[model samples]
Target: MSDGNAKKTSSKESFLPQIFYNALLVGIMAGISWYAQKHSVTAGEFVGAFASIPLPVVLFAMVMDYLFDTGSLYRKVAGKKGLTGAITALGVAGFFFITMTWLVAGTITMNFSTITPVIYVVAGLLTLLLLWPKTGTTHFVLLYYIAVQLITKFAHFTLLGGVSLG
Candidate 1:
């Protein structure tokens, strides 16, 4: 007779490919975040677009996890493949942040220049660092969207000359 352990092992193996698929989809959605800034004309549009993307991203990540037959925590902290996937996901999230932030800043009577793209990159990184650990996929996506909008608005007002403080 066969041991029970064999059946369990087979089950686990079967499930992991699903997990990998989920993670990849998450990465794809996160990557899309970068594009929002270009399309946004107002803060409402920015928030709307940013709010909408993460569920699909997370759903993809979940599917990838199932496909890979891996656990979330395990893959999140494991070897090279895991790390690479996370980084790609983060990159997608970054794009979303930049797009939404630009939208909000435009609403506040601020002037945005081509250089704003550089600022968006930098701010996106900082927000990700702060929010990623404390928040899961959904919260991280939503909060970053909001944070980018407000912070960039304040920064534009304080540091830039477009508003003409004088």
Candidate 2:
């Protein structure tokens, strides 16, 4: 390629869009919080500064997963056809996610002991949404995952007040 074309391409592919996305995430959260507090809406609860990850971090992780993942674990269970086999696969996937979440969270929540089973199933299904070959590795799935985080936090703050499930 010509130097002129390369320079044009680089200029067109500037970091502004990524910066906009990051700004949008922060702005949405802050706006929701501000509106809720100003209106005397119930602040759900403070999960923690560490409860959820930011959009940029999750986006970076998705890129890394796309580049480096072997898909061995996903492949192992994703091929099951029988109902019982599928259920087992779901359970295993759920267990793996919950354990990872716990490890990352570091501090245990007050409600952990009481709701382990429910959370396990939900988390499993969610993980599978991205693990399924038809959907998991797609560019849109990563965007959807981060979008979910954004919407969820917005809902929690706007409706429940500060956090979720308060």
Best model number under TM-score: 2
- Which residue ranges in model 2 land beyond 4 Å of their true spot? 1-51, 55-72, 81-84, 103-106, 109-125, 145-166
TM-scores, one per candidate: 0.26, 0.36
Q: Scored by Cα lDDT, where does model 2 land?
A: 0.43
What does each candidate score in C-alpha RMSD?
A: 13.1, 15.7
Tens digits of per-residue lDDT, candidate 2, 1-166, equal 9999999976654444334433433544455456445544432222222124344434543553453235665444433434444565547645645543343233346667553332333233334443434443676535654455565664422211122331
Q: Which tens-of-lDDT digit does each residue in 11-47 have in candidate 1?
A: 7764554455456545544643654456443555434
CA error at residue 109 for candidate 2, angstroms: 5.8
Question: Candidate 1, which segments miss by more than 4 Å at Cα?
Answer: 1-80, 107-122, 129-131, 136-166
Worst 10 residues of 2 by lDDT: 157-166
Count of steric clashes across candidates, in order: 34, 6
lDDT of 2 at 30: 58
Most lDDT-accurate candidate: 2
